[model samples]
Target: MEVDTLRLGFIGFGEAASRFAQDLSQAGLRHIVAYSPSAAKAVLDDAIRKKADDAGVELLKTPKAVCERAQLIVALPPGSKALAVLRRVRPHLRPHHVYIDASTSSVKDMEQAAHMLDGVAPFVDAAVMDPVPINGIKVLTVASGSHAEQFRAALEPYGMNIQVVGEKPGAASAMKLLRSVCMKGLAALLFESLEAAQRYGIADVLAADMARFINGRPFEQIMKRFVCGTAIHSERRIHEVSESLALLKSLGASTRMTRAIRETLQQITDMGLREHFGAREPETIAPVLDAIIDAKRAQRT
Candidate 1:
């Protein structure tokens, strides 16, 4: 379908959906419909209603109404409500309809959604990788499922960056969850460190040092040095983390991340990483990871 002639529907009208609706409308998608439960209450002052109005989106009373009016349906509800939303809209689904679930749900939930939509409509498990309020439809979205490419083909013409990463359902969600482990953990660690630094009147100095260290070298080299060094020096790191935790405590800053660092280093030291490496840092991170995995498996047994 041509961009101007394509009809799009959203199951929710939150920040992400609002941005998408407005952008897609500006991109020549003339028919945009949405069904946000909150849009029905006190229409004059409702934030969702105002968003829909600003986006030129036709706010419908129900999900079924959205499905009936548009063939390309995008679900943008919370992760926990993904399945419930699917179940509510399932009866209105048609084989020709393309259903895109863009919620930050689990792999299992995405797979279950695919199963529920099996033979009813083409399901696209889409993981929005960026903040929609900042990028709108230009946000990088990784999609996976049997019909992910089809979804990409449909939306890419209208300026949506939907990359098809796999043919299996939930593959995109898996990537998002795995990425969150690093991204969210890094955010937590930075938060804790910056809080302590701010209390110590060294926030600017610490931020500059972190930027210099991170931007000075290729990330792969940095990661390898840290991973390998951790294997060899986990014992010493535990002491350092304890001291850092004590400093943070003295400054009345949170010590959760510091405590986690100490516990993780303690766990690695207890796993015999120091003895395994024999005072020499491993050349690569693979052996350190393998040793940790082996130790974990041994413990499981």
Candidate 2:
């Protein structure tokens, strides 16, 4: 699978797409094109251009142009806008072209997109397993569809660690959705417990016990930080938990924990903490939370 000769296109040149383009370019995989919505296109174009210039890649104007320029298309648009992008690009998709959807969309949406792309191109639903910010270009991905192998080959050149989950179009999405339930659910739980513990002056003890229970696991530590961070970024955390709930429903599983997570997030939102927490680094959140808790306790006393 010689990826150098194959042109790669990106729909939605946002954070993820920019990272993908930059990483692929650094890996010496050229022939990249990208498109975003009309309003955001210019902004994204400039950012992507800087990235492309540094990595030596190309930036396209329209989604259709991207499709025309690349045999392998990676759709990194938001989950809500994924179907719209597909519909817009469907007319330009050609036979033998492969569409890899790396967005966090619903299983039904992925299946629908796959059906819409049938014959015109092979559609593979790819679930990105880690945050691209930390993983860079070598992100772990699980893809499923009739053309999984071909999609994997195309992405491999970009240093993708891809696994073919199954032949069903939505199988990979199902796995990602289910995994989000556990990953984000844990985050939500930690947030709620730590917030309550802080108010009651038990936060330090709770953190110590948590460390012992999890045997000081790196992910556990990360979750602790995520919890404190969510006190400020509750909105985004809420959205992820909402998506995780949808994923649970799609899998015929109960949404008990997810429902609880939403409630916890709402509590944080009601407190107007999203603005304060959203942009703050995880490392800087604990002291801010501790101060707020102390003030609240003093008022009550």
True-structure Cα RMSD, model 2: 15.8
**Index of the highest-TM-score prediction:** 1
Query: Measured by TM-score, how close is model 2 to the native structure?
Result: 0.68
Can you write out model 1's per-residue Cα lDDT over 1-301, one digit (the tens) per residue?
4555678899988889989989987877778998888874536777676778889998998888898899889999999999999999999999978999999999999999999999899999999998998888999999999889888887888899998999998999998999999999999999999999999999999999999999999999998998999998988888778899999999999999888888889999899988988889889889999999999999999
Per-residue lDDT of 159 in model 2: 87
Query: All candidates: CA RMSD in angstroms?
Result: 3.4, 15.8
Worst 10 residues of 1 by lDDT: 40-49
lDDT of each: 0.90, 0.78
On residues 65-180, what C-alpha lDDT tens digit does candidate 2 reach at each position? 78778888999889988898899989999886889898988999999999998888889998888889888777788999988998888778668789999999999989999999
Give TM-scores for every candidate, taking all chains together and pairing residue i with residue i. Answer: 0.82, 0.68
Question: What is the TM-score (0 to 1) of candidate 1?
Answer: 0.82
